[model samples]
Target: MSTTGAPPRPGPRPQGPQDAGYGYDVERLDPRGPGRMGAAGPQRRRRRRPWARWALFGLSFLALAGGAVLLYVFVILPLGFGTSLVAFTAALLPVAIVLGAVWWVDRYTPQPRVSLIYAFIWGAVGSVALTFVIGTPFTAWISPSEPDQVTAQFLGAAIQAPVVEETMKSAGLIGLLIWGRRYIAGPIDGVVYAALIAGGFAFTENILYFGNSFHQAQAAGEVAGFWQTFFLRGVLSPFAHASFTALCGLGLGIAAERRSLMLYFGLGVGGLSLGMILHALWNGSSFFLPVDPANPLGGFLRYYLTVQVPIFLILVAIVLFLRWRERRILRRQLAEYGRAGWFAPAEVDMLVKLGARRKAEKWASRHGAVARMGMRDLIRATVELGMERHSVLHGKPSERTRRRERELLERITTDRRLIGALTAPVVRR
Candidate 1:
């Protein structure tokens, strides 16, 4: 990482293009160097167009308004008295837990907070609102006859719900890839954003399901319905939406780096299709066997054992693999930058290991709160700089990327100086 201390000595530049074997052109490695690929000076910043600013504002307002309306319709209107309170309280535990898990998995490089919030809002409000609009009429058209209500329910769950809900949910991720391309650097980022969006959608959906379950149970003089639904949705399958949408996220995340239009389209379509299939299978599981009211959770337990558990295990394996990939990429990219004199070898080692990073933060805390915070920012900026460098090497390099690289380098320098000044006395003593 760049620091206020003397910069590392630059290695000998490759003598020829053929000698540049670190996957990036040797000539274009340093933006500040005097070479064919070097910037003559800083690029001028462009002012944002008024229409673009207004569009973002309009979208934000719509998201907030829609979320408020849904909260009222789904939670408040349907469940009066204390039911709404109980439902929201029960629903939030799983959402928080799942969100924390996703956030933790993104340890290598955290995403922009604004992008994460946008994704969650899009899923919770925009996706749900659109789903309600499109699904209600479609489901109504396929509503079963009086004698075949069970068949209609099955069709709605297996076919209609998956098609509509998965598509709507995946749309949020798609939009993120289009509008916030820089936020998603790899598969792990894709998973993180997908999980957040999915968690938000599940939270809203659970409010409706749990609230209705509670209301019906109270009417029938049984309180078990609420707890049972809670256990199933909240405890057992909180990651249902997340796992489904992760497939789509993985596709779009990979697509972001691709130059071929065909490959991008293929991956995007394949991912969305896979997510829909998984969702359909999950929803359709209820039709495979009969449920005994006496054994209220018998059917669900069987499905959970046979279906949900295996899928969840698979998702866990995939997540672990992706996390490992992210770490490897960080190490590889940062090592390249280190050799190119953007970071010292010791700094690359510290940045690559979570243990080392945590220890650095702990040491900084002994100096003061500000030192600790500065260390954290320095670490994050280092990782982000590595990712940007990786993008430049593997994908097409652009002027914007060169500018971001310069900005990140400057941030690392500032943060390092702040933390060093704060901790200097402690270190000397």
Candidate 2:
């Protein structure tokens, strides 16, 4: 076997646009590229006391919840918690929904829960905390001289918020993508992390907006300002966080997978800058410009959110569909590996889809708990083995997880040996 658990001589069998079972020839038809779908071994099962994992999960959850609340109250809330409660609540609700959706959907793969929490912390910590260090003086210097005029707000919102805010918020994902690479798979993973960061920033920001709006309305004895902020910040474009952090994730995904020289740095910095620019534009664009509200080009809110929002949704859908398609590709390529005497056909079928594996596990349970555990191991090994063999067929370079394929293969080989030695096959002749 070649290094990293993949067979060296076989080369990579790149998956293309096709359904599963194009036969073993799928390996022969793959096109080579910089972005190879390298394989990852399923998390190995360690037979320890069950409470160990539970304890770790509890500690991580506490850290995430406690950290965000602390940073918000002492740091962000002090700065602007009295700003706008309504807007804050509105913004906060949707973000919580999105995060909940991602967490629920990605149950098959054990996501890096810690990294996500850290990403959110990075947004809140960097946006408000670092802003105090770098932006406070600038704000102090500028606010006193200006008349709190439209010009001043424009400069602060458009110029400072976009550049400083996106950079600060995105830093968490960038750092994680670089340091905690083993946890990150690609752009979709990046989106999940960066979006969490963006959501946190939005949450803290909404506190200020909401509190301020409440006081402003109470003073005027009118809710127009509250409604305006709600519509502008909330309904007009609820996806502001998703947009800003998405670029960062795209960059991280490209860098993590691609094998280009400039691409690594280019993707990271370029994506961050892009996110900042978009944020800046959102800040700069005015809701009530000189033009009539009824006019075609009256406001950017009409153009950006209305026109661009649907486009962004479409793009997200496309990317998700591609990932799903890729999974199907892997299933087919791996099914071929089942024929090579490396793994059993039943094991391969179990991993072809999530539901099928659960069914097989139930069947194994009929024998005993040990057999069920062994079946699970067999399922994971077969899945990983197919991934390695596909890489071999396609000639892709080694990735972070691909590096461990060998250890996985060794376990699988050992398991196969155990099967042969432990149970005798009846002779048909």
Candidate 3:
């Protein structure tokens, strides 16, 4: 039940290296005396190699193109123009809701827009495209010789779909972790990116389901079927995919923090495996429910209430805890900067709380656009600075990290100067 804005209580001073789950000695950090980084002196800017960026951009383009082709062939051709359009519009509602929640969770330490977009595209287009490429043929090959339609559908939904879809989605996570390493500062970042990808996948998948249901209902003269499908998928279980994928993201995030290659693989596999299992169980539940003539959906409804609802609630709790943990990290790390004179204690307090940060930004708006923009950038950079320090303290205490620290310090200094100059007292001679 930790809250984002609750002020951190004072704790015992660090006695040695073991503190905050890292090896770094918080005591050893130099204050803002002469020749210290707290002064934010000029430093050399390092130029990042562009190959990863270019390669990622190129791959995203191909995936998007391929996805468009698949969309036209599979969804549009089968469902017709009007139905597809309706499905597309209907599909947007849940996607928007899920994406908004993810975005809100990520607000503490906002990631780069480009990276977020890449994650979404990978989920929406790349994963779906790959699933189509592999799933159709593989499913056909594995089809049982005994022609039991219900059994076949159950196998496809419970077995093939989970394995194929989660794997394809995980590929995107792996790519992001490899090429866009800087974007994922911790577990929350991992969740944010993973959820975005899931949101994208769900969007396209929903379109197919809704379109098919719409057309099928029309043909069967049972228009209620489409609405029922919408209620079940759209309202009742929109976040199902996101919850599953977030476990993988959580693993990736922990691995990123630990800076262990083995963990990157081990945890990634472990998380993906867990996700697949959960997905399978979720899909399999409906197939195995005992038929009750009195209440046809009694079993499914009970399972949804007892199993699905609790899982979703638990995931929501975990996300909230993680966000609160993020706030704590910012407060702890920024307190050290405060002691070093890089920031005031009041400023540190303002930066960690969402409400205070918003008020500060709003207050700055009265001074004009530059001040407001400077405030926003300063908040973002300050959060980044704290996260970078957290990353260093975790396991990556390399020279590159040191360089990033200096860069952030300089950027913060420049922002402070810009904002200060705007409100500084003018002297008239």
- Candidate number of the best TM-score: 3
Residue 13 shift from truth in candidate 1, angstroms? 24
Q: What TM-score, over all chains together, does every model reach?
A: 0.83, 0.65, 0.86
Q: Candidate 3: where is the Cα deviation over 4 Å?
A: 1-47, 50-55, 140-147, 425-429
Q: Which runs of model 1 end up more than 4 angstroms from their true locations?
A: 1-62, 73-75, 141-147, 259-261, 292-296, 425-429
Rank order (by lDDT, best first): 3, 1, 2
Query: What is the clash count for each candidate, in the order shown?
Result: 0, 24, 0
In model 3, pairs of residues that clash are none
- Cα deviation at 27, candidate 3, in Å, is 18
Q: Which candidate do you rate higher for TM-score, 1 or 3?
A: 3
Worst lDDT run of 10 residues, candidate 2, spans 17-26
- Cα RMSD of all models vs. native, in order, equals 7.6, 10.2, 9.8
Q: TM-score: which is higher, 2 or 3?
A: 3
| lDDT per residue as tens, model 1, 119-173 | 7877777778788788878887767545277877887898888888888888887
* Local lDDT at 383 for model 3: 92
